[model samples]
Target: MKVLRNLIAIGLVFLVILSSGCSIKSTNENVPSSSNLTVKMLDVGQGDAFLIKTSQQVILLDTGDIDARDLLVNKLKAEGITKIDKLIITHPHADHLGGAMGVLMNFDVKSVYDNGQITTTSTYRKYIKKVTDSKIPYKQLLAGEHLEFGDGIKFIVYSPTKRMIDTEEDLNNNSIVGKLKYGDFSILFTGDSESAIEKELLNKYKDELKSTILKSPHHGSKTSSNNAYLKAISPECVLISVGAGNDYKHPHETTLNKYKKLNFKIYRTDFDGTVTITSDGHGYNVLKEKVQ
Candidate 1:
């Protein structure tokens, strides 16, 4: 009887240890592997181009305009960036896909991601060809997809779902929107999506739309920054990527007024030059080339 009781006690102890070990393994898999990250929104004239750097890899969000290709290449080289681990293009528009060729030619890009919208333009055709010819891994990002931006960073895609892409009938409305989250800090990258899509996001995300920073939609076009959308996001600051004297006259006064009403800080590439942000998962700081 004594021997049987001893065996039963040992078995219970072993079972508890086994269960605890399994739980720990699963928890570790979900935890971020790193803690430091940097995002640089370049001052590419009249366009968008952001560089994300982590200890494990570098990500290029957009490539700016066709005419700005050389300058973009020069800037990357100056920063000692010879390789890009991931190149995420929001859509096939000229300003977004134009510098793709230059990037592919000058840097070793390992993978590419875009909205998968084909267009009838030489620029789009050539850009696709370059991506294919170089044998880089290519994929289309749809809503709900998650990307691991190494160093404890995660990017949650919120727009350009396959359903939206097939039905929107407009490229701008299908622009890739995503939230880059590191610890408690997050930045909402809006691409060039305008009003209609903004409404969809506002309805779907609701309170989840809030972030620490917002990359102003469509360069702060009056077509976007709707009251409901702005209220949903409620970012502490907003950044606009536009040329100093752009023909489009982006960042319309109406949009500025909306940001002001919300008491959100505004920064523009035209006036502030490059905007760089660094984070340590728990907190972050925003730095600009100029006061604006």
Candidate 2:
């Protein structure tokens, strides 16, 4: 009888140990990942461009207008970047993809990502040739796909789903909308998506739309950043890339007022030059170029 009791006690102890091990594993899986991601909104005058740097990777989003190539190259050189891990052309608009060819020619690119929409412009063809010559892997990101670059740094492509891609709508509507998450911080990047797309996103991912930082769509044009969409994002800071005296009058007064009403600190590339957001897993800081 004593031997039987001892055996039963040993089995109970083993079960307890196994349960404890599973609990620890589950806790580890739930812990948030850490990554140091720096997003730089390069001042390309009347165009849009951004650089994303994580601990192990560097990604360039768009390349701004054609003439901004030199400036973009200089910025990358200053940052000690000789290679680009990924290059994401949000759309085929000249203002967004014009200088991308220059980047492909100058840097070692691991992969290229775009919406895959074709355009007849010479600049677009030149970029395509560069991609072909480089022979780097290319992918057209779809909604719900997640990309992780070590250390828990993750990016979720939230727009331009396959259904939308097949319909052949406006290129702007096909813009790639991505959300970057590092630890507890989140930022949303909207590539010139207009009201229609914004409404779609708002309805689809209302809760997930919350972000700490927002890159104002369409350079803060009135056509984008609808009031309801802004409310849904509820960003603490808004970044706008626009030229000082551009023909389109970007960063329009009304849009500026909207952000002001929402109590969002506004950062403009036209006035502040390069805008950098640095985060260390918990919080982020925005650094702007010296205003002269």
Candidate 3:
């Protein structure tokens, strides 16, 4: 009888191991195939945060605000991001760079890129310290510089061709503008750039500014999306990052109407929560967070 009991116990152990193996296999099947590219626009409330994923690398655009630090870290973990190949801080505004210190402290970042703009804010100071302490390679992104993350994926800087010395203009005008091209699809990321900068970009890049998607400048501020810039880029879709009931009333009504008249599809963080766009180089699909 004792021998029979031992045999039954061994059979139970073997079954448990097989069940666990099946569970792990099922989980792995749900992850997207490595051949795809993903861009996630996080909803960080009044701030900006973006994650770009290629088969072999990960890139982070702004880090949102300090208040969203925990959320940002959790999101990265959820996406299985163990390391950041490149981190780009578009400008020095708190909303754009505040959470950067947390990200730098928590992840292994290989490199960082910025527009060389500075601000006296405490958040900005700490962010700089974090980057320096990590001993990561840092570069002042320049216009015409190309970033190659993997085969067929290219990111090109298009603004801040030269340092701005004017003390009168708002810092928003100094924001870095970049474009990402993956085969036939392209996206333009205009930091918090205003009208004056937009006019300059339109004058310089002209048709080169065209993209399939545009992260709307200045969170859809009326002063940023002038007709000339819109016509120059002629994006098929526009994304605006803003907080619900924000004090600035972001994504101004007039600006939203302008996009509507242009017949471009518009997505907003405030309304959509988080937006994820997946691309296969030639085509893409947009996914919105489901309301709870």
Better of 1 and 3 by TM-score: 1
What does candidate 1 score on TM? Answer: 0.87
Q: How far out, in Å, is residue 140 in model 2?
A: 0.8
Quote each prediction's TM-score: 0.87, 0.86, 0.85
Error of 3 at 124 (Å): 1.2
Candidate 2 lDDT tens digits, 236-276: 88999998899999888999999999999888888888887
What CA RMSD would candidate 2 show?
14.7
RMSD of each: 14.9, 14.7, 7.7
**Candidate 1 global lDDT:** 0.87
- Assess each prediction's global lDDT (C-alpha) against the native: 0.87, 0.85, 0.83
lDDT of 1 at 162: 95
Candidate ordering by lDDT (highest first): 1, 2, 3
Instruction: Summarize candidate 1's per-residue lDDT along 1-292 as a digit string, tens digits.
Output: 9999999999999999986654211111123344478888888898999999888989999999999999899988988999999999998888888899999999999999999888889989998999998789999998989899887788899998898877767988888999998878899999999998998898888888999889999999999999989888888889899999899989899999999999988878898788877777766667776652
Off by over 4 Å in 2: 1-35
- Cα lDDT tens digits, model 3, 126-184, are 88877888789999887879898786798998877665723434667778788988977
